[model samples]
Target chain A: MSVLALSVILAFVTPQAGSTPAPTAQSRQAGDAREMTLTLPHALRKGETAWLLVTVGMIGHNQIQLTTQSGKDLGNISPFGIRSGQAAGTYTIPVPAEALSGRRLVLRLSVPQAGGLHRATTTEEVTSVRLVIQRFGNGN
Target chain B: MSIYFETTRRDFLKTSLATAGTAALSRHLALAQAPAKYRRYSVTSQQGQKALVSYAKAIQAMLNLPADHPQNWFRNAFVHLMDCPHGNWWFYVWHRGYLGYFEQTIRTMSGDPNFAMPYWDWSDLAQIPDSMFNDVLTPVASAYERYTKDLQTFTAFIQPSLKNYWGKLSPAQIQQLNIRGYKTFDDMWNDVSGWTPTPMTGHLSHPGHFNPENTAFAPTPIARYLTLQNPQLSDSVKKNVSKGTVYSGLEPTNFATTYYQHIPIANPIKIGFNSSTTASHNTAPSKGTVFSTLEGLPHNSTHNYIGGGAGEGSPIPNGPWGNMTNNLSPVDPIFFLHHSNMDRLWDVWTRKQQALNLPYLPNSQQLPSYEKEPFLFYVDGNGKQVGPSIAKEYISMSRFGYDYEPGYGEEIIGKRNLVLAAKHPTASVEGLMKGNAATLTLSAAAIKTHLDSDTATSLFALVTVPRPTENSPNREFDVLVGAPADATNITADSPYYAGKVAFFCGMMHMSGMTDEATFIVPLPKRKEAFANLSAAAGNVAVTIRAVPSGGGASVLRAVTVQSL
Candidate 1:
């Protein structure tokens, strides 16, 4: 850090090949998220538990970053990991107790794939799969 | 969607000519013409004859109303439950047997082999514009018109008696009574189409308990009395009258528990709520069949309603089918008829509906889109398996199979406590050949499984899967099970149980993939033993099977003890 700062002050810094531009505040604001889709098992019963998985990706590289948006927080997401070529990974999620079975819900997956160096982002809304929970017990 | 073929006149004439060559023309024609009437012994007697006549007239009058009119729909549904000309009074007997007796009378009189009544298929009206209740260019329009007029006439005839019961009522009160409907015969006489069944006596008063003959609440025996006094009939008709009331076979709890109970009742056969005082009677009390019948437990925590062994239904230990007092339906008199047919079929198939021949998860394990205890009505035959050619064969009996009664075909009750089967064959040479020849037929096992630990004491059957070799393709299969023959002596075999309780295993797998076969098992008539035994100490078997499609299927076996 000291050498880079001193070099900048001395005007000795030079741009290197394959160096991408950092995102500006304005670019980050303009490049919003697009194309969101959530996937899950088709059904779950009331009072039953199930795992919910989420994924987010961007259209182009080096222009956008994706993140989770707003909704009722059921459970926390898994630790993030990096994909070498595909730029995709998995995350485990939880289904809430009050969440009804046999119904669909939309979860916003932000702009695009995270870690897209210098990429602009856009968003899209896609319907998620439905979940249905069943009843239980004897002598009903 | 059915395949059709053309036939030649030459073939038909040739067959007729061949037949004529074998016998004289007159003899052949006479042979084809008909034979003498076949008369069976009659069960009706002098004491019940008058009541039977009155009941018939009441039913006919009730039937002569618009299908959508609340009263007409209610009465029709009631009659349907009591006298469905289908698989006898199976559902009625299972849900309410009193209605079964009434249905038997109707069956006896009509001489219909099967209890099939005409149904107003609403799908026909679904395509028409304006209202589903009416159609512009069909016979249905005329039917509806006649129904409306008959309802109005009946209402006018019954209005005065209702007024006399609660004398000099205010305009607002009278309007409320008319709007909501009538309860007593007098109230109905004053306003036939708008009477409600109230708890206490009104103008059509009679000194009889509601639960006569230990059946459902009696309607105060007003119909017979009125018919006897009518001046329209001849002396011979009056002389042939009978007087005792037959049970109406209404299970008050089944419909009341579903969305139907919310519908307002007007001269209902069974009074749902106590309408005598100003207090609201809709709130169920702490104890009694209304709420206590459910074992005071959550639906999910309680035993599977259609699953498990015996002694379940309504009215607690009495079982819903055995008790005649439960309200079956309010919007339809055919409710009794429909149930009766359902029960009769039950008598035929017994445990076929709860077989393990289909795909299911073992020990109450539920599949996606379903929970452990969630149940579905197949609409097909009581869990019997069939092939594509005969897929549409199991139509509602009331609509077709017009002459269905004793000895229509043959009744095959599967061996008691033996596993019934519906096997899925492989799609290879052998499987294809089996599928081509596999028609809908029921068979039985000779040996019965005893109620002992080593015997497994569990229900089992085979499920059919097509193309089991296919890679993760969606497959379909059917469940098969063994049931008691119609002549089974349940009391002799199972001394402690009173009625049947059907139990079904969850989805099972065939080969590598999941199969969707469904089956139900019923408890034989020995409920007392079940009550006396400790549930925690007993070991129960929970079987799951998975059958693949397009021929050969694999099987998975699992069992568990009673967690309770």
Candidate 2:
């Protein structure tokens, strides 16, 4: 390989040294009711706000509903606030401490279509997810 | 489309110097343009990636300079540290000057004369470009380990030298620092330390009475909050940087805000893109603190998310954060890239003003004080201080001799002049949510001037909502006009969609026990959204609803549609 090509390859493949891996999403979907549950290493520390970072390849406008196993609703995460966009990529949904039942979070992912809308996600697509927690209040 | 109008931002300041006439506003006038010397590109672009290598080299060179050297990486950050503005109008122009000089420094150091800083369009990408993590570009690189291993280590390494440099400030520079509440070195250090003397006892050494923690310096590598693996902005930050919100920021014609408008207490209209026109950038406005939507929303939220301050990457409630979160934010390599995008947005906004033939700076009466606010601390790329400079000098991008490679909001520059609509009197809301019967009374001209997308005029609805209790299920509500009374769970695609009004009052008033909060929701200018309103014959009644973004009971108070 050329030196430039090798450098580019290494840049993509290499991971940072001494970095800890965050927990990933475990997906469970019935015919149409799609869901993903994430377990945190620890319960969100006191004074912390958090989000469920979901990487999905969405075809059209879509949103995710963040809630707990016990059905305590956090909120629906929508791109563009009141609006919806395809927003296909690694996107975050607020997973506040109140929604987490002892380090466990269940997300109800949906791509609610308007009349005649179809195929929010294609078959051949890759997805990933993680939980991010911050003790900072964001000056709340 | 030509970005430069014949006049400059300085001309807006000194309207007495030239005819402030509508001749500049004529749609047919031909404008002569000069190409900019540098062009900033998006980090996602290949050219931007190439520029990163040069940028990294410049960072490496700056990092190796002596502690007191003006161009030293840490010393360079101090220029921002000593003279940055927040919550006011100087916010945009100040950053433009800071980034412009730094870009020049990078050009000289990187040996790439064409090198302009590549911007991270987080509004689009939502992640710090993956390449930002490589080598000297990331703050955690080995090059920074010595100066920022920990607070004590960092202080010990740089304090004495910093103090010596502080002692040598020229009278004018010292005067500016004094105006910023930094009369002494310790006074300046207090901001860095987040220190507060006990109010009751007036004692400095009161333990537990002190702030939760001093944001003294950068955290240790082990405590490094953010990483390459988790560079994506959290969803909350993305909420502000969305295409809809960014364009809303650019929609305002005025650069600096009018004083008595769209603040917490008043229903005064005229919302501008940047904040209040204040005497000094370092201080709060004499009227009231107002941050332009762009500054308050996307600008701040992005900074916090990257610094792990916004519910990401486990940042502590207070104390040492990644250099991006604090006054020393310039210490982060990503700061330049992040700010370059901000400067570009200002350019985009300026170009749109040129297209609209609108004044892009404070009016002439407000000019002298606005421009005279001294910026004395900046050191040029050549190691000499930028002596006796003022805010007006940094008003235009041409001052730095750079332009932006067209990014997200540049489409506004090509927007043809919106047709003018005849002036109309004030309009008011007639009814509330009564089985889809909520109505707004409007003058006939309101349809073309306010509701129609074809006109330059804008009309905003001042939405009033009762302060939600801590137990309120959702703190955000979506505003819709002419929606069915029963309409629920509608998205942006709905024709009834106006905009969302969030109860970010505690985020606004710091805290509120108040009865209500009012949000200014600019009615969507899309003609299709108001198709029904134009068709109404008798009493022009428009249905309005404030449904929660989340599924819950609506706590919307009152909404008033009026024009100034």
Candidate 3:
């Protein structure tokens, strides 16, 4: 948030606010999200906890939101126990059993600088994303 | 932007001398006499090891600077702490600018006219160069023990100056912080303190807010998580930086498109070489932005592994860890070498895109806001403030007058790896809805295209989920398709597992905005997922369901399947 980064490939001069072109097209429909589908393994037993390991680039704080395909709005996923984003990018998002109950599911996640209020118009990306099932109650 | 004028204000002289042939000569002669670019060599080379000696000298000088000085080693790390972006398109360009200027500082301080930063090229040399473990090259050395002896000493030495710097920030920087969700200086400081007011004083709390004690203010010698005794990366980390993974890191053709990967994989997995794009370099993860495989893979994993944050990029101990794990990473000498590799990978990816005759960067039209985004915080070799520079200035290594010594993936140069355009990519159908499950009936033609080895069109489920609200109780949810009833949570290993959707909680619910949000999710491409469809069939029935991540109700508005 402290810096603004743009890839001006064709021009070197910084454009004045009004003179800058509108985004030509969005990769997706609404926001800046570019998604590549990944496979999800591991199953959670009742009341079990799982870790959503996401490799982030540099933003300090991130937020991840989840929802069921039935459109169940789960609030921001809590950090696995006390471990949140310790590094510049590695985040531990704990997914509890209540959220993984159904035979099938759909979720909407956002690991934000802090996802709230302003529409996310900034440029950002994530690297590796996966869920680690916590069979024991120790590591969050 | 012709820096040609930088040579001299000889406009009149050039104009008078420029005959038709002279004009051509001006172009070709300048071309033939290309200036010598600084060469960043691999650490394994003698030249690179020599550069490390100078790098050590420069780092020591920066460390010796007064705490109040902008070029002080800690304050330089502050530049990264304050401005670096991860998980976004600017990830590459921002770092390029950071490194370019830092390299200049090294040149100036080390007194080496030909000095260029040496890169670790982790794929080639998996262990840290033994030279880095010696003297000032390691953060654990005696030189760093002075300022970073402990939190009390560090806080006493650095806080006052940092606060003064914060007080001096321009209004524009403050405004950017506002959009980035830091409303006040206290908000930013709270992240350092890891103390969030229960009620929301500026909403500064983040991922590990649940921790009673979360702070990044400790950077002692002990804070160096990896010692010379354990300098090797874990086996998993070695895999992350393996040659094949680096190739995948260079695979995405588009500079940026979707949050994760907007386009289908070139080879079932080969999309998103670069990270996704978003609004601000520091913007939160939204529908528009997700992690590119490279940043999410090698870069982050490497940081965590060295810092021992996650013990090789998985769940490890919740760490005070090392400086490498936190925003204060540059405190460790290894940080520079690690970033050099990251920057090198970006260079390789850029050249690969250029060789394929594809756009290596986002055209202005793709992200209009890009050009206006100024990188405001950087210190130059003379210890002078170097920005408000924009991203374009650092988009190419040429901007910094440097080039990398040949390493892995440089082979893409002059090689013609053809990429096939999507053919009949527009075939799609609607998915019939059931409880959390959608039955998408596909035609034989749709199945064939999806199954095509050469021109496989990626299938995505445009799932409609609720928009993020500060009041929302649920933050994360898992998605699974055709899994058994007992199989609820899933990871990448499971074929029936779809993906996980997460939200940043803690924002006020927007009023009058659309309540429903649509996400373009790529369908899993595992052959096992479509085994039944091998025979040409009229249609297939697949059940996609949403698992409540945190105890919450299901509310899927609709699911549309499309191939692109």
Candidate 4:
């Protein structure tokens, strides 16, 4: 094998902490839903705003929700009502002044199945995402 | 049959300069014989600023009139013309017709027969002109109030609610109260939000809402944040402003040289070919190649950078520019100026292509039903309202009596030395696995030298995915340039987060076909990262992996990166 090819192979084999796993063909297949991992800031103080930037493969009629660990809804993503696909945008999520007591937050992304029924229910969806957010003291 | 009209350049000039009498008639006749000679000026120049102010005044006057009145007709035209054929083969041709009619309306209203529209050359100036922000002309607050009263009277006849709305205010009360009038042409153009006096809704003769307070009938939040020279913005915002203000995908130095200079005239692969034989009506080849590297890169990048959302944590965080969006863009006057520059670029590209004896596409191909579609109406030279005419009628600007100022291209291509070290060899890798990374090598010394000299030196990767069928689900891919180990961890916040590729329905469903959907990622600043790579690896390697967007499998056609 060439030096370049060797480097590529070795780069794959040598694993490091927090490294993103290479997506296989099966992971990217249509209808084979996969969980999307977003890299958000570790913690937000009370009354602080964090801009969550998500890159979705398809942005159809979907909704991304942010809430507490026990499922108290913070808010639905704004600039919503997406009609097309392959979209990217920033959503501003704010931690209220009262939420300083919480230690953790969760972001849930719900995308309805393409042609399947049960469009209203979020629990039984084919592709769903949950990202945990760590919290810190209110600085201000 | 092709409508053949020929006139000498001198006659065209005379026709453009002649006033609205018998001389204007003769000039109009001359116009039919050949292309007219109206020079489009840059907005930064003295003449260009003057022309823009004049246009604002004329549009303001039009705004004051009733929606159906002759003066207001031009302002009303934008509502119907937008969100149709942008980002496709017809983008240039349709706008040419749209702007041509608008210029005629301006001449009729302003009475400056020689008046031509000025273009905002963002690629050259890299910022919205200061004149666009500062008040250059005296405020016409009283005149605006008078027009608003006139509009109130006009609309009250159709909608009684407007009569009730206006009954509360007297002329004396109106004069005492500060009614918002345009302080600058930018003030008039920047309001894209919605007009004051709340547009009329129920039982109006016109189909759309009318804004009596502002011309263009739409309100825009004076994009005060758009000025690149403003010092109050944070360093990060300033950086975003600077990068977003200019084309980041290609080096200004080698763009015109390596790409445009090397383009062959007759090569259908570079510039699109005409499949139809109809004289004077060339159709874009249904399958042939189009768009040279330079044109395609700057064109799409400018659209996305400008219209796409402002950076996260920006002063106007996530606020999108109207110029970036398709449907509401025409409402912003900058839309015209930006498009005029785009048209100017097309003109330059055509000239360079023709110099090499390029075979022009038969009538410019348009989206379905738009080939011969009429786009609004405007008052002609004889004071007669004309058009609702097809785009074919306005194909050539000269045919309509205007041309860009001489040497506009050369002026933009002014002395800039090409960084030979910045140029990277074109490399392609097959089977670029989704989420799996592969690296392409580049000369580290070249990257360091380019960055050491120009802090704005950016790395751009052109990711080409095989063209998908019309029904393919939308897919997006993220590209990064750095150490192979760090490739997977690079989020949108990471400096290595170049940008993403979005394959939407509108792009895939467009009439003309592209061999591949080429996405240009303006890689974030990574000079130090590049330096580290150069010290250790002797070369910079760019890694690209498909971010799992759950669409069709992405088949890599080619991937090339260069320092710009």
Looking only at chain A, give the TM-score of model 4 against the true structure.
Answer: 0.37
lDDT of 2 by residue, B1-564 (tens): 000111222332254223223323432342457778888889999999999999999999998887878898888888887888876778888898898888889888889999998998877798778898898888888888887776667677677888998888889778778877778997777655555544436554554233323353565462235578877776545656766557656765555644322222211223466765666787622224545657756776566556545232334433344566656778888888888888888888776666555666666667677787788777787877888899889988889888878888864553432111112224445445454234576654665665443223356565666556665546667677766556677665455666655554443334424556665555655555454555666446565677777765445566666553
TM-score for all models, in order of appearance = 0.23, 0.57, 0.55, 0.40
What's every prediction's RMSD, in angstroms?
Answer: 29.5, 19.7, 19.2, 20.7
Q: Which candidate would rank higher by lDDT, 2 or 3?
A: 2
Local lDDT at B70 for model 3? 89
Instruction: List the global CA lDDT of all models.
Output: 0.23, 0.58, 0.56, 0.38
Better of 1 and 3 by TM-score: 3
Candidate 3: true contacts recovered, fraction: 0.00
Stretches of model 3 off by over 4 angstroms after superposition: A1-140, B1-35, B199-214, B259-270, B285-288, B312-316, B418-564
lDDT of candidate 4 over B1-564, digit per residue (tens): 000112223443353343213333433453465445788888888879889877776666565556445345323343322113322345566667667767776777677777888986654565556565443121212333332224344233323432332344344323322222323323323233223333355646554442311222211332123443641322222232232222221111111111111122211011121111211122211111122222233333333233332322223322333333333344345556767786776665444333222322232232334355444333453434463456557656675777776433532121111111122223322323434454566666656654553223344455566444556444555444453553444444445544445555444445655645655444445553453554555665555544433433334555656554
Ranking 1 against 3 by DockQ, winner: 3
**Per-residue lDDT of B142-246 in model 1, one digit per residue for the tens?**
332333334444334333432442464444334433432323335333222222333335646644322221121112111111111221211111111100000
lDDT by residue (A1-140, candidate 4, tens digit) is 00010001001111212444322111121222222223222222211222222222232223333433334333332221121222322221323212222222233333323232112213222122212221211100
Chain A TM-scores of all predicted models: 0.32, 0.56, 0.42, 0.37
> DockQ of each candidate's interface versus the true one?
0.01, 0.02, 0.04, 0.03
- Clash tally, candidates in order: 180, 0, 87, 19
Q: List the residue pairs that clash in candidate 2.
A: none
C-alpha lDDT (0 to 100) for residue B101 of candidate 4: 66
